[model samples]
Target: MITHRLVRTWEVLPSGGYSTAWAELTGRRLAARGRAVGLLPEPHWVTYTLDTGDDYVTSRLRVSVDTAGGTRTVDLRNDAGRWTVDGAYRPDLDGALDCDLGLCPLTNTMPVLRHDLHRGTGGGGSGPHDFLMAWVSVPDLAVSANRQTYTPLAPDGQGVGGPRASRVRYSSGEFQSDIEFDERGLVLDYPELATALTR
Candidate 1:
C-alpha cells in the first residue's frame, strides 16, 4: 500500500538525454522506477527499478539497458550490508549502503536523506561522510565497488529566501561537483552532469 508518491524529471547535460522517475513510499520503504535515454559512449536507453529500506539504504536494484547490441539486464540485492549480483555473492560490495547508478541523479538522494545533509546539519558538524557504493555502469549493467564522499555546503538561498534549497559537494577521486538539491532532497542541478526539469 503506497502512502505517498512523487515524480521527477531531469535533462542529461552532456549527452542531451532525459530521464523521468516515479517513486512510491509505503510504510517505511520506498520504491521507484525510471527510464533514461542517452547517447554518451554510444546510443542507448536504460530502465531501472530500485527499492530501499526505511533509512534510505538501497535493498534491491534491477537495471536493463538497450543498445544496438540488444538488451541486457542485471539484478543486485543488498542484505544486511552484504551484496549479491545476478545471484552471485559479491564480497567487494559487502559494506556498500547504496548503489550509484551511472548518470542517474536519483541515486544521490539516499545518502543526502539519510544524513540530513539537505537540512544543513549532518555533514556540517561531522565534515564529509564517506561511503562505499555499488557503482553500476551505464548501458553495460556491470557492477563494481567505488568509494565516494558527500560534504554539506552552506545554503545558497535559491528557495523561499531561506535554506530550503541546499548544496552538497560530491567527490569521487579526481571528479567533484557542487550539487544543488531542492527542499525535498531531490537533485535540482548537477554542474556538467544534469539538471532537474520543471514538468
Candidate 2:
C-alpha cells in the first residue's frame, strides 16, 4: 500500500490556542508525531504507533506534558491484547480494545475510520454500538479502558458516498467528552476544546 502523509494544524477552542502534527499511514501500520502547545492547560508532544489489521490489535503511545506543577511523562503499550504503563503490565486493562492518547486528536481517528462502523439505521434499534477502548488522559496522565459510542449526524452534503461527520461520546469513569469527526474520521471540532485546521 502507498504511504500517505498528512499535516494538520489544530486550534484549542474557546481559548484559540494552537498545535500541529505530521502523520503517516501505511496499509496496516500508522506512525505519528506531534507538538501540542497552549492547546491544553499545559503543552506537550506525543509519538504513537498503531499496529493493526482489521482492528486495533496493538499499540505504543507516549507523551510528555509540561505543566506548572512540573514535567510529567507517560509511556504505554498494548501487547497481545494486554496493556502496560511505563514498562509494567496492567492486568486490569487486559481486555481493553483500543488506546486513546492524551495529546492529539489525530490518534482517535484510527479506530473510527478503520472500523467503518455502520451508520445506525434509526430509532431504539441502532443496536449495541458502544466500544470499549483504552483511554489516556493528559489532565491526569493515566490510562484506563473506556466505553465510547458513535452516531451519524445529519447529512452535511460532503464526502464521496454520503455525509461525513459523526458524533462521538466517550466516558472513562468520571471523564467524558462529546467530539465530532470528518468523513476521513479525523476530528473536525472538539467543542470548547480544539478544532482541526487542516482537512
Candidate 3:
C-alpha cells in the first residue's frame, strides 16, 4: 500500500451533540481536503485511490466517534459506497454486519468505482457482489457469494476480543476491509488510527 497516507482530526459529540473533522491528503499525499458534520464520530476523511482515477475529486469521509459508551468508527469502502463500523461493535447483529448488506440494496444505483483493468470489471453479479471481504469471526458457514447472514466475527469457540484479523476477498472487485479482534474475537481500538478524538 504505497498509496499516500491520509491524516484527519475530529471532535467528540456531547451525547446527542454534533461533531466534525477535516483532512488534507497532497505531493505524496495527493492534494485533498475532506470535511464532515454528523452527530456520531461517524468516519470523515479524504480517500483518494490512484486506482480509482479520482485524483481530482476529494475523498469521501469515514469517521470514528468517541462517545460516552466507547469509541467507534464507521468506515465506508469500495466504489459501491458500502459502510462498516471499525470499533467496539454493540455485539448486537440486528443487521448483517456485512457492508455488502447495504451495497446490495443499492446495486441498481451503486456507482461503479473505476479501477485499473487488472482489477477486473463487474460481471453483473446476481447480488451486490461480495462485500464480505471484511474479516469475519465465523467460518463454519460457507461463503454464500452474496450477503446472506451476519457473518459472526467469532464462530470458532467464544468470541470476546483478541489480536486477530478477518478479511473477505471479493469475488469480482478490488475491495478490502478487515476487523482486528482481541483474543476473545471482540473488536479492539486503534487509538492511533482513530479518525476522531473524544472531547
Best by lDDT: 1
The TM-scores of all predictions, comma-separated, are 0.92, 0.74, 0.21
* lDDT by residue for model 3 (1-199), tens: 3443334333323222222222222321232223323342332221221111142221222433333555444443333323223332322322222222111111111122211111122222223332322322111111222332112232233322322332112233333332223221112222222213321
Clashing residue pairs in candidate 1 are none
Order the numbered candidates by lDDT, best leading: 1, 2, 3
Q: Say which candidate scores most in TM-score.
A: 1
lDDT of 2 by residue, 1-199 (tens): 7987878878866333665767766774667677766535544443344444344344777777676677777888877777789999888777766677655677677655555532322331333346667778865677877677654433344432236555555444565665676555567777656777777
Candidate 3 residue-wise lDDT at 70 = 56
Give the higher-lDDT candidate: 2 or 3.
2
As for TM-score, the candidate ahead, 1 or 2, is 1
Q: How many backbone clashes does candidate 2 have?
A: 1
* Candidate 2: residue 119 Cα off by (Å): 7.5
Tens-digit lDDT track of model 1 for 41-80: 7899999999998788899999999999999999999998
Worst 10 residues of 3 by lDDT: 101-110
How many angstroms is residue 156 displaced in model 3 relative to the true structure, after the best TM-score fit?
63
Q: Which candidate, 2 or 3, would have the higher TM-score against the true structure?
A: 2
